[model samples]
Target: MFADRAHAAPARQDPSLGSTDDPERGDVPGWVLITLMTAGLVVLIWALAGPALTNLFEQAIARVSGL
Candidate 1:
């Protein structure tokens, strides 16, 4: 009984026989580009504002300690 049903089932096409476009292509490169861009922006912002931020923090600390 089971054998008849199994033979009646349609054959599935092999994945290698399908479209040339890959489902997972470029996934890593896209993430790497995004991560690199974010890192570069963070570095640029830090470089531009690092001294000012440090001075502000030091002033705030001095005021608190003086009080």
Candidate 2:
């Protein structure tokens, strides 16, 4: 109920994060690391595969254009 919620004390934030910051916000660093690692993997894979993929595409286009 609205009345019960209004009467209850507010939840406490984590002490190390400063008083205004929520404890649950800690997961952002982990998510950022995961996103950075995924991006690095994508770049590495593209670097390794880009020339082969381009060659394959050119061959396919050449066959079609010849037809």
Candidate 3:
């Protein structure tokens, strides 16, 4: 005695492999991914530049003081 009409229709399988039946599982949105990548790049750049800048400043001071 199933009365639901929606369930009466046959379910269709997608031709595309690895595709989700639901839209929510798709890859992260473009803007969100870009923001995340930008944040990561900024952090990486700062980490690499910090020590190099400190060393350069120390060398400059030493040269000026004849040390």
Candidate 4:
């Protein structure tokens, strides 16, 4: 009795589909923002650790030179 109702319905068009007009497609903006944020984080880390790194290098140099 269920054999007559087993036919598939026609495919419907989607209204929310994206257009293909833009040349710079994909996640370019997201990648650029991520790179900028990573660079900012690196700069911040260097700023916070610069003095300690300098001190450590100075101590290493002094120890090596026997001064």
| lDDT pick, better of 3 and 4 | 4
Per-residue alpha-carbon lDDT of model 1 for 1-67, expressed as tens digits?
A: 9989887967776987764467856577889999999999999999999999999999999999995
**For all the candidates, what are their Cα RMSDs to the real structure?**
9.6, 9.3, 6.8, 9.3
* Residue-wise C-alpha lDDT for candidate 3, range 1-67, written one tens digit per residue: 5678666977677667545667866566887999999999999998999999999999999999999
lDDT agreement of model 3 with the native: 0.85
Off by over 4 Å in 2: 1-26
Q: TM-score of every model? A: 0.61, 0.60, 0.40, 0.60
Error of 2 at 19 (Å): 10
lDDT of 4 by residue, 1-67 (tens): 5765577674565657755555666787899999999999999999999999999999999999999
Each prediction's whole-model lDDT (CA): 0.88, 0.87, 0.85, 0.86
What is candidate 2's TM-score against the reference?
0.60
RMSD of 1: 9.6
Better of 2 and 3 by TM-score: 2
Model 3, stretches more than 4 Å misplaced?
A: 1-28, 58-67
The weakest ten consecutive residues by lDDT in model 1 span 18-27
**Which residue segments of model 1 deviate by more than 4 Å?**
1-26
The true-versus-predicted C-alpha distance at residue 43 of model 4, in Å, is: 0.7
